[model samples]
Target: TLADAIFRHLDHGAAAGPSLAGRHALVTAGPTHEPIDPVRYLANRSSGRQGYAIAAALAARGARVTLVSGPVDLPPPPGIDVRRVETATQMLAACRAALPCDIAVCTAAVADWHVANPTDRKMKKAPGATAPVLTLAPNPDILAHLAAAGPARPALVVGFAAETHDLERYAAAKRVAKGCDWIVANDVRPETGIMGGAENEIVLISADGSERWPRLTKEAVAQRLAQRIAEYFSPDRSPA
Candidate 1:
């Protein structure tokens, strides 16, 4: 009920102000599960709260949003299309399929590596037996792929960087490496409580510069980001 109320209030505010009507947005969220076997997988602590909030905010502003999410406990936001996924590969495929969108926000905590040869059957354990070794392979760089999508690339591509140290340095490097328009950087160290917590302290990095944002609820962050997106598309506004 609290989330519903928040969404309603934000939606009402967005509807009364700048709108993203006739625009399409693609958002990716949650932690991808890299399977090692039929019953076991690797994942992170992402709760998908921020990504879902962003999707809702964009939808509230009248953008047609397609949310490609990994496993998350939260429900899908209202009035937006949702595509559920598991592995990083699947998430990338789903994102590619939602192409030609005007905006792209990738917030998924996609695993950097996946099991090179996953087994279909559940792995079994035996007493006095050596544990099975897993070989890892690099996962696709979804943000980079989308950024280099040529004619199909979204006009505004945003990516998230969850780091435990050197937030600004790593995020700025990522922006160049991924070729995305912007990078939303946040410290996700355990004490920060951002990995699975409601509040976020972030730095919005772009070609112009970085803006430090105060700690706020994920919903508030989403609303602010949505407003920025709307401004970017506004005819009177200059590109940042």
Candidate 2:
């Protein structure tokens, strides 16, 4: 990026994490936009605060960050390269283009389906129009794709579960099916208000077991998650 080029004359570089130095990290953010017409799109209530915070935390910990993001109104974090995309397919392409990263954080609330054939022209309602039918197709699961990247897979692939209920059980099932190294599960029920809120609570599920964390600020969540990632990759890291 032109902004990153400003520090071209840098030496070894001053960074926060020594262990994660020289590692490449990829993070996807926001909801996928499945277009129904030229003007309308399908998406979710994701402010991208959580994903952005995670990316910033990882970058601060010395990893080269590539944020593959969907359309959102938030500002990109500093010292990180941003790849803007609208749909899940575009986001997947961006991730593929920047493959073999050391870590991948699948944080984007990607849509599971898209309009099978979206009209290029603006869809109009006739004078007595009732409703328009849209055929839907499944969007590629970005997390599953990254986890099964085969040769170019990241060392650590983490997936997120935004379920309305049975968070742990559902997340575990997704973890096994998606092939991710870890799964961060959260309950997004109406009462949780975690969809587009400032605070979050989650449980990290891995091969060893599950670790529960209390509700905290988004920044605090990022910091704690980053620390867990650091420890997991540490030479002497151990399961808690």
Top candidate when judged by TM-score against the true structure: 1
**What TM-score, computed on C-alpha atoms, does each candidate reach?**
0.93, 0.91
- Candidate 2 lDDT over 82-121, as tens digits, reads 9999998999999999887989998999999999989889
Residue 171, model 1: Cα distance from true site in angstroms: 0.1
- Model 1 scores worst on lDDT over the 10 consecutive residues at 9-18
Best by lDDT: 1
Q: Rate the local accuracy (lDDT) of all candidates.
A: 0.92, 0.86
Q: Give lDDT tens digits, candidate 1, residues 117-177.
A: 9999888899989988889999999999999858998999999999999999999999999
Clashes of 1: 0
Q: In model 2, which range of ten residues has the least summed lDDT?
A: 9-18
